[model samples]
Target chain A: MTRRWFLHPHAQVFLSVLLSAASQVLFKKSAPMSADASPFGFAAMSSGWAWLAALATIGSLLAWLYALRFVPLGVAYNLSGALHVIVPLSCWIFLGEKIVAQRWLGIALVLAGVLVTAQSAAKIEETIEKEIEEKP
Target chain B: MSPFAFALIFASIALQVGGQVFFKLAMNQTHAGRTARYVPALAAGVAAMTLSIMLWIGLMSKFPLSQLYPYEGIERVMIVASAALFLREKMTPRLLLGVALICGGLILVTAS
Candidate 1:
């Protein structure tokens, strides 16, 4: 095996999720808080946080692409749902945001979903690898 | 949220899903040695992703991160659906159950 442990599919997926969570936080930090937040506007790009958010997004995308080489897009996409939980928790911790009871329950449910999906992903990958091996 | 905002959210999600599917196609093309198709597929992927980010940032300016991020859960469901539709990825029962849980959580998050 190569020394690039981070290039491992699982590691790439984990890195992609972490970077995506960071990107969400930074994008929120960069937001102009204007009522006229048009979807095509460039207002967010004025902030330094926006640049960092862009960088985080690029990193996440590259990692996700790398992971997709080994894992099916379905599995990789499901694995990335971890970002929903991470972003909210990060916002609460670093951005001093509050999570209401209903939102907390929602986040918990999302976490459960991610865990279950990840488990299923492992099984799917195993079966695929086995089928490939058997295909003399 | 206004109807316009809801439309933006749905458009952003669609673009994101399109980006992922295109990127997956590019990767598969690369592995298949179809270099001619890879560049355009990868370019399409990048363009869709860039547009999605722009829309997401715009939406973030109007909504709280906590409230908005849950919408990403919806993308998880959509991507899996698209993967099944476009990529022919099998949708196991466990995967469906997981996605159903995510959708239920999203309804709660967005509803409250």
Candidate 2:
């Protein structure tokens, strides 16, 4: 099989990530106003919007299944939580949402942190490869 | 985050941002008595968003918060690119510099 044809587990994980990102943008753009728009409204207001949200949720579940097939649990969890920083900031700029300077700085720091973490991970992989090679 | 993990997180962030932009565009098409026409697009967008969230939950179930959080930076790059391409948003020198700094930082974090 050609290298491209081979589904590297990591590639699957990456695709899932991309899908997840795309889905988020779509859903937010389409989401209906909250049913509980009132000061004390308790129930969710129903519309076609909720149904769309449900569809997005299903897509996410499918992606999760693929992600779990190869990636370890610990790694997946960390990656998802980090979305908190990414999704909101992107919305600020692309969607014309207001973002304060402090928040922007925080986002920058988060990006820097990701790079550092990735580099460390690569070093770990290198060490592991060397150790495997050295083994009898 | 692992490289794969980082990529996934970044992608998810980008989509979330994109969704917001799409919704705004759709909403801008509003006119009296035309809410029904836009329903289909809205539905699709919502589905996509929910799917993204589900993916995130799945990732969370498996990984630690610290490891996954930094990959969010990838969204910024994606958003900036999208804005430039689709929205005709200006790419100011300061913004470009910011993007570079963020990229470098993300690389450092990932490499460390």
Candidate 3:
């Protein structure tokens, strides 16, 4: 109900966002290098980013698990959609992936959606708090 | 996509959603200080997630990263629905708007 959401509880959600995006990037990097011939690919396993991807994924899930304690799964998951914007941008910056104008427009829309979702969640929280106060 | 591929994708996403719900229940239990109550939920969550990852890997083997990633956006809708149903969270109009915008934007971004 305070800035505590940003500074404390939801910070874990933010970390989930970053780690999830990073893991996706690592997967992207490793994808091309993965051996195409077999299910058991030492080539993919040997890639450092692939391993990092696995770790980042576990880290993201752990952070998400902790975050689900205080935050509504709806709110946390909606904000996690920020990765729609984050992953491609990270790929563009770090992986030199191409960013066409269309993608940029899509990114803006995704950001707008995130803002709206967050604002909506905050409104819900405030309403709940007001109800609790009135009842008590 | 082939029927098998589509089914795999659907199953993978379903498993991911199920895992998320299990994880949420586990955390909620833990929050109430019933630490022992969370173990089965956590184990189930992990199992669902493992299946999801395996199914996803199978799907990705056939599809381009760009083509398949947008399907993940479906999570926003699934999570919102599940939250409303299970957690009794109120579904506001703005939240729906946001979900629409996100899905639209994701479709746009992933379009090649």
Candidate 4:
């Protein structure tokens, strides 16, 4: 797999992953801070941590947009799948959350899956580029 | 628990997938203001996502988070399928494997 895409600022996929995962964790941690989390809970909406989570979400969204400009939607989506593991693992470590054994196994599977996906993405991109060249 | 709620969940998934696809289409545009295509796609995407959020809120009121969480895993699979079909993106065996693993992992994680 080429490291070029990883280093490219325009790709931003890696950065998107980090920011999105952070947003998930922040949103989870801040959920309890909201006294009432109903559809129209004005007090819950104004919580400081909720606002922080919202900011993180906005950052993640912008990073996603930036990344999409460079990468295919499929590859970008697959790369971000690692957040399934990251958010929970970070929560277990930082938030003192309890994770059962099965969940750990699942997380392991996800990490392996993401590695394979990342490798596949470069190969696919090369093929697509080749196709584009051959056609024109 | 009813068919209608499940339908709402499915609609939400469709909307989310639609929004992502349109956003991709929007960004594929070369010019900022001139391309009439991207703007419509962008507007539709945002509108779909906004409606999706409302559906999700409705779903949350009816079902437990754990019950509804599996749909997010379902979403991972759908978006890949979506890219393949609508965006004409290539999908490989490893990519499919990755999707399965991630979905499985998401299910196991949320089940806990």
Model 3 TM:
0.85
Sort order, DockQ high to low: 1, 3, 4, 2
Looking at candidate 4, what is the lDDT of residue B67? 55
- Model 4, residue pairs in steric clash: none
lDDT string, candidate 4, A1-136, tens digits: 2534453423566677777667555545544433234642233345575567667766777777656655778778878887777776777776676779988887888888888888877765665445434432
Quote model 1's TM-score. 0.89
Off by over 4 Å in 4: A1-11, A33-36, A39-43, A124-136, B1-11, B31-37, B50-69, B110-112
Q: Which candidate gets the maximum DockQ versus the true structure?
A: 1
Ranking of predictions according to lDDT: 1, 3, 4, 2
- Between prediction 1 and prediction 4, the one with superior TM-score is 1
Q: Supply candidate 2's per-residue lDDT for B8.
A: 59
Query: For model 3, how does the per-residue alpha-carbon lDDT over A1-136 read when each residue is reduced to its tens digit?
Result: 4533443445777888999899877866765633342322334556788799889999999888877776777777878889988988897898787888887888888888889988876655655455434432
**Evaluation by lDDT, superior candidate among 1 and 4:** 1
Per-candidate DockQ vs. reference: 0.61, 0.04, 0.47, 0.41
CAPRI level of candidate 2: incorrect
- Interface RMSD for candidates 1 onward, in order: 2.4, 17.0, 3.7, 4.4
lDDT of candidate 2 at residue A105, scale 0 to 100 = 62
Off by over 4 Å in 1: A1-4, A124-136
Candidate 2 residues B37-87, lDDT tens each? 656655655665655555554454345333454565565566567656765
Q: Candidate 1 residues A1-136, lDDT tens each?
A: 2465555677789999999889888888888578877766587788899899889988998888877767778878777777768877898898888878998888788788878888887766655454434431
Whole-structure CA lDDT of model 1: 0.80
TM-score of chain A of each: 0.84, 0.56, 0.77, 0.75
A20-63: candidate 2 lDDT, tens digit per residue: 55545444444423422321111222434334644654565455
